[model samples]
Target: MYRWPFISVVLIIAILLVLAFVLNLSIGEVWLNPFQLFFSENLQSAILISEFRLPRAIAAVLVGSALSLSGLMMQTLFRNPIAGPYVLGISSGSVLGVSLVILGGSIFSAEFLSSNSAIIIAALVGGLAMMFILLMVLKIIKDIMTLLIVGMMFGAFATSVSSILQYFSPGFQVKAFVLWTFGSLSKVDYPQIYWMISFIVLALFFVVLSLKGLNLLTLGTSQLEQFGIKTKRLHFIILLATALLTSSVTAFCGPIGFIGVIVPHISKKILKTSNHWRLMPVSMMIGAFIMLVSEMLTHLPGSGMVLPINSVTAFIGIPFILWILFKPLKNEI
Candidate 1:
């Protein structure tokens, strides 16, 4: 009975994913008929479908999958329903990195560092630096609450630095920074997509290996110890994997949110299972579907103006968050 329901949910999500993919490709600035996408003689339409929409769709899938998985891992690690990638401030670290390059370049008149490649590098470096610091602190701290507090402090520090840079930045630099923070799937190109996918795959490999540990962890640290699971070591591995996933998405897509926090809950609610083996794959699918929907909403069928992907996600995510807050207390996973 349980297996059938889980399989049904997977099948439903898979179908929606396919439909979303088709709609994403077909409903851009110029709508292309599904049948004619491959056979269309219009060169401009073909280019739009192949060159532009395809990359954005691919980005949505990868970013959604990475953020959802990362958020699930975090929620599991902290045993908190609300914990998410952005909640830990890793995304802020990336923002600070990008701000330093964009705003700093404008302030110092350094044209060379303002390029897209430089910005990506700076973001990656800043995110990894923050991850390293958090991992180091995790070694000294055993309490999950204390670790969360430390992560918040890191985020606050990064935000303060970003604020200072923004205050000193020129109009154009500030504008650029603001736009990046709004988040986007359209910014990813083919080369960046390749790297993002590679990083996600590697991080997910680590996650798959640790599934049994994750399942044991849900039973509490004592139970984990009883099972011969090295809780500290496993926590390190989970955090490291999460950092890799979160930082890569933030670096490439500029800190997309809500999908991470929302998708896992949606998956758990649907699957009614705490087993990581089941939860992980379901969360990935639901996350990707939500992102595709968000991407579709960003460009309404007839709307000429493109909305920020972040705004659409906020609309979808905030309601769920409020529900979680006000609902009667229950086991989250």
Candidate 2:
């Protein structure tokens, strides 16, 4: 096995993360100097930092780390490089949930379900429903590839249902659904961020416990079984953990993409290691850095206009994905 410069890589990533964090905090609609954030006497700047930018920045870090780790687990479990956190249809499930609330509420005149909190709840329920279905399927089918296919089918089914809802929805309702699909970190307030972070942290605990199993799984099922690992049970635990992490982020952030799909590969490329212990934390940090960069780009700095976070992520993700597809040693990455 090749040796990786783990310490050096970690230090570099930490520096990047710190820089991204400062830039994310400082450059917004109303730019504030980095020093002003801590010591400025202006009350409005303090409010903006605490009330608005802080929550969004925290959300970016939490959501990015959660999705990236989830993606790494899915890739390990399925032994598929293209497999992502949303590959299990949890995000589509979230979309379906949001669609029902946003579109359905419009049609039914149900004002209660139209609120931000209600929509987040609906998204969580929808995602968990699909996760439950996947768990049931996992019990019936032991083959990993087949389960991956089934998950895709479920995602397609959820998407179709959401499209039907959109078709029946009025213009304003359709617009609302469209905007939600675009993804936003700003919508998450401090209270929502607290719960989101809590769930992600809990899910991460399960992931940490399974780190040894994840390393074995990377060597293939036979190797895993040779170690007396119950692949099915391990798979269940990882899937559940992935579901919890991915679904919570999707519920609150509205299915932000590319972090899960791209960040793990980036970590592998930089760290030059397949070991989960190194890969997991590096991926989390890289994910956070990328998300902070994405958030900064969305602000457009001097333009006073913000781009959709989803668009920014896609722009960054798509190129890396293409590189992976076209690389001579694609499978190795």
Best lDDT among the predictions, by candidate number = 2
Clashing pairs in 1: none
Q: Give model 1 RMSD, 1 decimal.
A: 1.7
- Residue-level lDDT of model 2, residues 1-333, one tens digit each, is 565579988999999998899889998988889866789799998898899999999999998899999999998888778889999899988999999999989888885778898889999999999899999998988577888899899999989998998898899889888998999999889889989988988898889888989999877663457698887888888988999999999999899998899998888788777799999999999999999999999987578788999999999999988888889245564
TM-score of each: 0.96, 0.96
Query: Candidate 1 — which residues are off by over 4 angstroms?
Result: 1-4, 328-333
The lDDT values for all models are 0.87, 0.89
Find the candidate with the highest TM-score and give its number.
2
Worst 10 residues of 1 by lDDT: 324-333
Q: Candidate 2's error at 55, in angstroms?
A: 0.4
lDDT of 1: 0.87
